[model samples]
Target: MRRTQLLAGSALLLIAAPVSAETLKDALLKAYNTNPTLTAERANVRAIDENVPIARADGRPALNLTGGYSEALLQGPGTNSINSPDRRTNADTQLTVPIFTGGAVRNSIRAAETRVDAGRFGLRGAESDLFTAVVGAYMDVIRDEAIVGLNTQNVRVLDVNLQASNDRFQVGDLTRTDVAQSQARLALARAQLQTAQARLISSRENYIRLVGDEPGVLDTPPPVPGTPAGVDQAVEVALQDNPSLLAAQRSRDATAFDINVARASRSPRVGVVLGAGYFNYLGSLGAGSGVDVGSQSGTTGTAGLSLTLPLFQGGRPAAQIRQAQARRSQSIEQVTEAERAVVANTRAAYAVWKSSEQVIASAETAVSANRLSLEGVRAENSVGNRTILDILNAEQELLNSQVTLVTARRDSYVARFALQAAMGRAEADDLGLEGGALYNPVTNYDRVKNRWSDRGRDVDPQPVATRTNESKPQGSEVTRPLDPILDTPVDRDAVNAPSKRP
Candidate 1:
């Protein structure tokens, strides 16, 4: 019984222990596997892939069957039964194979294939965008948590100072004004802590929304890899590798093909038509006829080449060709626009990343100097050379600098990630996510591009992304215990003591 009790106690301890810290890569991997937006884009690309086979089907053979039965209720008085076939039944089957479509079928297939490539590049763009958002949210939480910790610590320190002020006043060593100043500072510190905690909660909620899980103790993220050394280099890489630009270029190529498909409307179409039919007279052909019909059934077969030329289409073909040409022009302009945007974004991200580094360096210096200044002011106050307000001001400056430092670090990291994304290097593969193979749009495209089966289908889709509502409610987990001394009332008699010079 004692051994059983010991075992249960050990299990309870293990259950209560905190889980290991979650790393940035872990959060990114989860978002990659479960983000709804990325998943939907992937599905859209797969749908686009089907267009290839759909276009090809237009050039393939088509077979159709028809059957019918009919009976004449009344015939003309002079009509012959053999010629009219009073009761009749017929069945027919026809097969038509396209011999040539004046390049319409060929270009349509090419356009569809090009669009599939464009969709794949678009998927890559979506992936990069999602990873950038996750990186921002992750950094925001870390920054807010640090700010909350700083404010909480400030509150505790102020509470202790307030108590000391009350003690000095009771001994007639400090004035009422000094104690009031300390109390006011402590109140402000508490308010700041509350605000910081609120911001922290908001950041955590955002993190959960994107990452699909409550954030645990997050490990500090490593520096973003593959950062370009300069803006020019970054822009050059972006112009070459940016998914948005590449997708736009592909779309332009597809539109060129679209123009060819439309111009084919004026060209002649040729095909082979083969048909077979059967007819039954229902035994009514020889009834009451002077001549006896040898048989009441017959079969017919025919095969021939079919041709169609567009003589005049009420100017519709010309209008369609012009429309396609205009669309190709628009696509060409869009490609240029995408390129310009990529260059601007790459340059801007690089600038921000560099500036953030400078801000971090400056903030660190300010924090260190402020800390030394606060210490000196406190030492001077101990010798009655500095006023209480001077020490208070020093502490406030130090807190401000420390908060700035924390914020700058977070900004720097997020900006670096943005830069990497702009340069087309922040995707899942670029990040080296583990635990599974990366989702390749080509896999789905290759599987469906040449498919000929009519009944093939994927399994019904279940929800891949996790819902946030099912997770625990977000709260400020970075809160610190309030100083117990803050709750105790100051001795009223000490507060009522007359002011005295130190």
Candidate 2:
């Protein structure tokens, strides 16, 4: 007996231990950790970082090493070759640093910087997308599970109605048709339960696909936060805070830099070059042998500045300038379109969220009313004043109302997050992801801009400079240093932006 008790206790413990629960916070963290798509986005961001250094390289000098070995035929008819017989080795090394490239160097650097900024904004946009996907998947599973619970309760209610019908029929209080009606309702309820179970299974699979593991069971969702003040408030938040919009803005900035880069190609480029050389030869002059540099100097060094003024380049520079200008125009339109989209989504999501709260409240009341009706009908049936059909109808109504309530509660919760997401304020921080990474506008931006500001540092960022509103301007041009993660827009300078604090 003691052994039996121990086995039963162990089995119960196992069942209890497996009943794990998950919440939205848990879902987002897991998605961030395990989702391959999000990881791919991060890799893309890192790849863009290299562009900053590439642009910076343009502003610096380029060094090359030249080496050659050759054997020469004697110009003379006899053993006397012009200098040496098939045995000469020459080596030269040159360092060419660009002192000036019209403004090409600076322009290229700016374009690169803008590209880095675009990439960072892209990172933020990616974060927002992943945030929504995780939340939606989480909500899908929770909603279906609630539906399953409601279906099970519906089956139970049908069972009670079926029992009542049989009791009434035996005493002639209910007819054959009434009994059949109750039986049919029970069958239908079972069918619905099966359907709800199937949906729940699919939902669970989708959740696990994104989160990398089965959530098993979800805890009850919390209530949505109170509504925002109005449509304007939601729209304002979305425009001010959305990463997507910032991405578009950065794209615009990049195009603007492109215009400058194209224009700079037309100016003169100046550079300095330093060279060193060595020449030696070893040969047999017919019967006479000689080993030496042959009276020629073995070491030499030269240094000078080279200026390359673009007189003409087949109209390519002009074409590039036109292309960049067109892109700038397109970027402007895209930014305008993106802003409109933000406002529309914010308003739509907020409307749904507010309406759901009211709907859920009303549904709760309806469920209570239906439950009261079911109880009253059962009492009437016992006294022969109500038929089995009436009681079964009231029970069905109660079940439906309960199911509606569950849906309302779920939708309301989902809409709250949706509104936040739509307004661009929805973040991992808002969802309480613990110890989340802060926005690193500087780290990503310096990947591009830091090269211009700090040339002495041994380590350099990427080819493209990442700029943000957070960067402060240097002068007439927006020679500001910026952090890449910043999304907030500011108008510190039109021609030159300054003091960017992300």
Candidate 3:
């Protein structure tokens, strides 16, 4: 069994270590450079780019060409007829471009541009989320590394204590109760060590899977910006940057355009046409009229416009307009609600972080106090001045304080990220960190979409941002190794740069 386990461990290590393998940054950058989601979103955004051309085409001249042949024969006619079966063929071409459409074309093009902006915001949001995910995974690896070290130190300390107690008992210097107490303490510590080790292993595995490879020492990011002057300011920034809100606004605008399009449908549409033709006359009432004469040709051109007015349609257009208005209203409500939600989250995270910051400091001090008390009790126990139970109680207090400090620190780190997220400001740039090759969906979109589109570039300038729900596993996010906020001051301007939201 021992041999089997040893072999398995060695195999895992071998798999983790690759020869000539890429650096962690290299690997992540490569994957980011070609991630399918980014590419997919970029294409979606660019598809929005075509609306301008389509709308403009509606206002441009339309030209068409037509040609046809016809043949007729009359048998046993009594007299030279003015009209007999006439063989005729006509070739014609006409061009008609709509010179105007009240507001349909302009409104449609404007709507498309607005939709593009929404996509840009959405893409920016997704970019921010990707950065957050990568950083969180990186942080998880760091946290696990720290915990493994801490657990190792704890197990060693417990082992030494147990050995010391055993030595004392061998000489009949320590009571059976003292020996038993040391053994029990050592066992508890060992259990904790095992649990910690398991967690570290699991965490490392999860990070590797998400990141696509084993992690190494990551370049530490600069500290986060301090809390803004107030929560309202933070909320304002979030409201402006949050892609979800922007998308909602875009939705409302598009619906207004839809109203224009629907209203225009009730109006008449006009255009122009030109043509040329050839004809053969088979019979004529005049005495000189010839039968089966050579075909004569004639050409003509004319400007004409065909209009379709919706006088009535069972109230369908009215119903459509009402539906569009309702959608616009719904979108407005969504934006308002989204803004409120962000504000509430920002406040909540701020409160929790502030409280945890103080608690972490206090807990560290408690751990120190408990450690000293446990030492004093142990010293007294050696001299038969303190009871074994009392020493054991002191040890428990020290352990509890350490555990509390660990939890508090973790909570503080998590809260900071949550706050940043609430503010719609969590991004790769926010970390002042960079990966090798960035995956840029826009560039990829241009390369793929430009091939068939004349104005592909104009279509999809918006960044794609995806919205997530509460169903996301919050605990999956990794805690940073240390609090940058507590360690170093961050630049406020750098932190609050204006642009698309993540």
Candidate 4:
């Protein structure tokens, strides 16, 4: 009974050990939460968020404190010796506030806010890139693993063939040349298996670097996110949602505000200053000469307004305004370029995705046909109607077809992901991956935008009412349902049709 309990306990331990197969969603969530590159970009966004406060500081009040003490010896010409002591002490406080800057400060603040918005969009672009990269790595690992399996099976089959060929040669059914051919093919198969193993190792290392852990048996990837009906609709969606284009648009808006700021540099500035002071003179009477001092103290206060107009600045303000205008023009060109690129890329990805589906279907058919041919050839060889070389060749053809089918399937999935990414719909919510907290760039921005304290770091922003003034794409033309082909798994039996001839 004790031995039985020990065996049962061992079985329970084996079952309880954590060795769950990782999924594509797990890899994506791992990358999203732990990737150092993404984390660095998040920090960069937070740093950009500080610009708003820095700009607002130009329009806010500033206070300063001042204090000083000095001791001196005075000597004059009256019995004239160096024996006069004098001391002075003073303390002062001053406050200066900007009343106006001809709208420069306000425009600067606006520009900073726009830039912050641009940074947020930039972060979104980084996220898309990161998720895309994780997808690529995850798929690479899966692809290499399948290739390794195929290679291993190929080697095993070749080994068995080599042994059979040697036995046939001994029995006088096969010649020595045929046995040599089998041996050579087995050597090549083993080499191929080694190559596949190396590739699998490399892919696993990359997975570790990107996902922060070694890979496990990964589940098959699910269908990708938001799908468009056609290439035109995909391009349209990209134009509306692509983060890079949105960033450029915000940047253009910011540069326009910058032009206003540069022009404001030539306008008049108004400010108010308030000062209060306490002055004290310590008593030091005349000693050997005619040096005299008396104890005295007084407090004084002043308040005044000032204005300054820029009359001449060596044409600097004009040059600045011109520079700002040029930058605005450059940003506009950037937005145009970004739009063009998005349209071209979206169209290309959509075409690739559509083509991959066709490739998969055709490759599956080829595999099925080749499999039937292989079986028929083997049956003929069993009756001495076909040679061993013919059987080997048929097997090779079937293996090649299988490999091609696997590659086509992998490409189909990858292209679908690329299509989703090109349309800016490859985010966590769209993919239904709810593993961890989604890092919202706007959360950090809103948290730091109006911060006034310097004690602790800013807390993550709580959910607030949506801003109605937020910019949005206007008048979208296409709103079709997600394409069923891209959004649902293809029919497996159709993709893996049985050998009809067999």
Highest-scoring model, TM-score: 1
RMSD to true structure for each model, in Å? 7.2, 17.5, 12.4, 11.2
Residue-wise lDDT of candidate 4 within 197-294, one digit each (tens)?
Answer: 78777777777777776666666677775668888888888899988889999999999889999999999999999999997755543434444434
TM-score of each: 0.88, 0.78, 0.69, 0.81
- Candidate 3 wrong stretches, greater than 4 Å: 1-39, 64-94, 163-191, 205-213, 240-243, 274-290, 296-301, 386-400, 428-502
Single out the weakest 10-residue window by summed lDDT for candidate 4: 487-496
> lDDT tens digits, residues 1-502, model 2?
3234333432332222123566667777877655767667666776677677778787776667888877665455555543445576778999988887766667777777677777777777776778777777777776666566556555655665566567656866557998799899899999998888787777666666677766665555566454679878878878888878887888888887778888988988787889999976654333244444255336888988888878989999999999999999999999999888888878887887789889988987887777667767666555556666786687677767767776776677777777777766566556667646744555754545456443444456333222223423211111111111111111111101111222
Q: How many angstroms is residue 18 displaced in model 4 relative to the true structure, after the best TM-score fit? A: 10
- Model 1 misplaced regions, further than 4 Å: 1-19, 74-79, 479-502
The clash number for model 4 is: 0
Model 4 lDDT, residue 263, Cα: 93
- Candidate 1 vs candidate 3: the lDDT winner is 1
**lDDT value for candidate 3?**
0.58
Measured on C-alpha atoms, candidate 2 has an lDDT of 0.67
lDDT of all predictions: 0.82, 0.67, 0.58, 0.72
Which segments of candidate 2 are over 4 A away from where they belong?
A: 1-20, 72-80, 83-85, 163-173, 222-227, 284-293, 383-386, 435-502
Candidate that beats the other on lDDT, 3 or 4, i.e. the better one: 4
